[model samples]
Target: MADDKSKRDFRDRDRVSADEDYEVEYFAAKAGVTPQQVKELIAKHGNQRETLEREAKALRGNG
Candidate 1:
């Protein structure tokens, strides 16, 4: 069975910007997902730093 957390669309790729640098594990923790998932999202999306910020905001209930 898959983790219920993994089933959720927690990572917001649209909020990511292209000119920022973010740590993989940090982003994953912020996004409530796995680091590998964060990496995949970064690869599929464009901006990583922006995404990380967005994920952080989401985690903080600010996004």
Candidate 2:
């Protein structure tokens, strides 16, 4: 469950953060990757901001 905990700490789901919906686009743009690539990154890593950013950087750096 360690990975589950890293998927963001927003437990109360009644209100959704606007940024959460745009995570794919945001990270994709920030990392110069595609939205689909961002989704793939999420699958491999996690939805946590740090994890997503780290993976995005690694992906960009790898290419």
lDDT of 1 at 18: 26
Best by lDDT: 2
Candidate 2, residue 54: Cα displacement in angstroms equals: 0.8
What is the lDDT for 36 in model 2? 84
Alpha-carbon local distance difference test for all models? 0.54, 0.62
Query: How many residue-pair clashes does candidate 2 contain?
Result: 0
Model 2 RMSD, rounded to 1 decimal = 8.5
Give the winner by TM-score: 2
For model 1, what is the alpha-carbon lDDT of residue 43? 64
Model 1, stretches more than 4 Å misplaced?
1-22, 51-63
Count the clashes in each prediction: 2, 0
Question: Tens-digit lDDT track for model 2 on 1-63?
Answer: 123435766563322122354645655776688888877776676566666677778888999
TM-score of each: 0.42, 0.60
